[model samples]
Target chain A: MPCPYLEYRDTSADQSFDEARAFCTVVEEFVQPMRADICNDRYALDHESHCEIYRAHAEGEE
Target chain B: MSYEAFLDGDPVIVTAALTGGVHGKEANPNVPETPEEIGRAAGEVEAAGASVVHLHARRPNGERSFDTERFQEIDDAVRRHTDDVVIQHSTGGTGAPDADRHRPLRTDPPPEMASLDMGPLNRYDHLTSENTRGLVDSLHAEMVDRGIKPELEVFNDGHRNEVHGLLARRDLADPVYATLIFGPGTLTRPRPEHFLTAIADLPDGATFNTLGFGRHQLPFATMGILFGGHVRVGLEDNVYYERGELAESNAQLVERVVRVAEELGRPVATTDEAREILGL
Candidate 1:
């Protein structure tokens, strides 16, 4: 699952999520999308664990 | 080629720096940290129009490593992933032993090009890179012996002045290429007039590549294109695609420069053309 804060903007021509540039609500900034393989790892806990910004924000919330 | 060629429309060579020694993933997660990641980034940038990939090796822990075996690993991976992009290694570092700096040039097939910082410069608040003349001369000698082209890195005007002394003392291959870096700290100020003056002060017949740290990257790259010089860009220099927008990949940075150059009537040089222009 993608980071709850992650939202896509300017989708790539193929409209692939991996290629789309994204906006992070936590940081209020845009960022390059995470790679498909990294985002789709089934064993990973959550997308926030993969993103430093989201992790930091989630930690702050805790 | 000279600025006169700007009217004649010469091809611009774009170099993508895959990773740098200073910063890493914490700065931007997309900044490749491992050999495999760098190789993939190299392939992506090459396809996006960079003919040369400037590389910096990192330890498994993600700290900078100038070790030969590490560079060899990165080089091998780059070659496996990219078809014909030129490989150029970074020999500049902060506070490393001078002898250790030479290790990057000792890779089995020796890179086609390596950076040779012309003089010393300050990095962060307390660190200084003492690129003494002895180190510079020794590195150049090794590069010459290994048949590697030197990319003289001029961080400030004093370093740029040293370029003249170097040319006088050493027998550099033709079309002397230098990278004029501009930004804060010890680098020349990122200003238009300063860049023009820097280019004007270059040794006659010398080629220049523009490098501007962070937000200055685009404007300086545009200036480089308009002035008939080459450009260096990638996450190594600036991690942002725009203000507040982190760059997606090295290829994303190269693609923008390629587009800018194309719209300005400067065709991007292919790998073969870049080699020919640099006399590689």
Candidate 2:
């Protein structure tokens, strides 16, 4: 089963469910506006590894 | 207890690619999903002569996942069935979050081996299976730090090149294990001709395994046996047992390998034997 949000979101942004947890708070922040929507609940900033999050940003920017 | 079983001079290690990240019960109703199902499947495969289980943890809903808690559950479940059999967790999957892939390293009892995909892969066709240098470096560092072996996954020549460079690096220890996947796409077709040549190209003290997709799975596995290498098999590579027929269980695949090994006069390595061969 894919993340519930995967069907509507960018598939490229789609990763494993744990990845959503591993990434830092940025993606969560990006999806913050949609928190009220139960369909987007998987986008919370839980167990955000500052290292993976910041590095992903740095790599993405590069 | 001793690993002398592999030293009979004709040892052949069989690794079971249990439940892959892509497939579900729809593809094969027997595909293990829950911890209980995976554990039962591990027991069956072990009895059928599989020394290693290549795991791709899945959510309760059958979605591919890498949650640490879930992995721990899977690990414990597998151990409950058998202890000597090595548990190798996968870190590569299409859409796998870069960090989530490494969650295996963070498990309470880290896996004996975790997959480290080398270079890039063109998945299906459109998506490029990317493994950036930073990610590779970070994964290697984590593996070394955690005392877990890297089951290097090489798909193409560029992946071979990456392995070549990695062998020279100080971070990785000697006696690395490489699983060369063939028949993924036309780009990485399982070429039996290059199997030996690829192994020759690896640095000193490297063991290898082969995964042939679809129709090529069993043939390539035989090639590995004849070539003095290891083999990985399960519905993950080819869901069918024959033309248009779905396999009943991973154990069926392992049983076939055992029969093939017998015919070839090569002894299937026991779990203890496999550990020795892997230096675990």
- DockQ for the candidates, in order: 0.03, 0.04
Candidate 1 TM-score to native:
0.82
State how far residue B79 of model 1 sits from its true place (Å). 0.4
TM for every model, in the order presented, reads 0.82, 0.79
Q: How does candidate 2 score on lDDT? A: 0.72
lDDT of 2 by residue, A12-59 (tens): 243332122211244542221112111222322221221233445656
Per-residue error (Å), model 1, residue B134: 0.4
Q: For residue A22, what is the lDDT in candidate 2?
A: 18
Per-residue lDDT, model 2, residue B19, is 85
In model 1, which runs have C-alpha deviations exceeding 4 angstroms? A1-62
Provide the TM-score of chain A alone for each candidate, in the order shown.
0.54, 0.24
Clashes in model 1: which pairs? none
Cα lDDT tens digits, model 2, B1-280, are 0112223446889999888776656456677878888988999999999999988877665666678888899989998987578998888754456877678678877888889988776543224557876677788889888888898998876788888787766456657788877885633566766775676777667788878887788988887777777889997777888878889999999899888877877889998888888888
